[model samples]
Target: METNEDKQAFEPKVVAFLCNWCSYAGADSAGISRLKSPANILPIRVMCSGRVSPEMILRAFRSGADGVMVLGCHIGDCHYIDANHRTVKRVTLLQNLLGYTGINPDRLVLDWVSSSEGPKFAKVTRKFVEKVRELGPMAEEMGKSLPASKINVLVEEVTG
Candidate 1:
């Protein structure tokens, strides 16, 4: 049984991958507009969502992010003129891979938010944070599938 301490002490950490041209700017706009979004998310600004490689997402999970978000331009609105195409393809594949590996695909989210959509950005961030808080700690659930040997390697990789 979970203690009251567990419930009161829970603070989910999230990693947000934001496209520099749009979603990152949207996040900035949200801040400028004084929209309240959860402070749990740590945003990493990339040139494009297309640049978020599989290794990076997996590394985020392995490094103790309870949830991850990928935000970019709309399907037809990529600043790189189709850069988001690769993002769509890659994230779709990554979602499936996460599911197969026994991780909840819902722990990851993909959305499009233009720089003008500060409200949308704040809403999405708040929603994702709440969802992660409900889902509890991912690292604990993941331990069921991870072998001790693999964990040792992962620990060394992260800590060394």
Candidate 2:
């Protein structure tokens, strides 16, 4: 018999899209500094947060990511000059879309972490992991896949 304790022990898989110039360096610094970030995070480095499109995020979730994080430089600090501005907008829209698709918007998060803020990176990642753990397994939440026709209608609603 599965107890509540067994369910509470679930560890969520998290995918983090880190900007190459800032968030990735911050994660590296966190490791070098021996800051304890959760092992659940699988980091993927991107040239800029703006480059992480909705399709990529959807793919991550479809591929079994329980949660996704897009971390970038602080506003006005992006190496690409204002690129993260687009990141902010895109993530907001994506979160709404995720909600519409029956996914909890909280499953997606966007935050800024500069290269020098190793401690912040560790703290942020730890908190996010804990939150996802509380949310339980993605497979449980997504028990039934939305039909293709429903997906098409949603796409049209969002795009049209």
Clashing pairs in 2: none
Per-candidate TM-score against the hidden true structure: 0.87, 0.87
Worst 10 residues of 2 by lDDT: 142-151
Model 1 weakest 10-residue run by lDDT: 139-148
Question: Model 2 Cα displacement at 114 (Å)?
Answer: 0.2
**TM-score of model 2 vs. true structure:** 0.87
Q: 77-121 in candidate 2: lDDT tens per residue?
A: 999999899999999999999899788999999999999999999
Cα lDDT of model 1 by residue, 1-160, tens digit: 7887896688999999999999999999999999998999999999999999989998999898999999999988898999899988899899999999789998999999999899999999999999998888997677656447777988899999
User: What is the C-alpha local distance difference test score of each model?
Assistant: 0.92, 0.93
Model 1 residue runs over 4 Å out of place are: 144-160
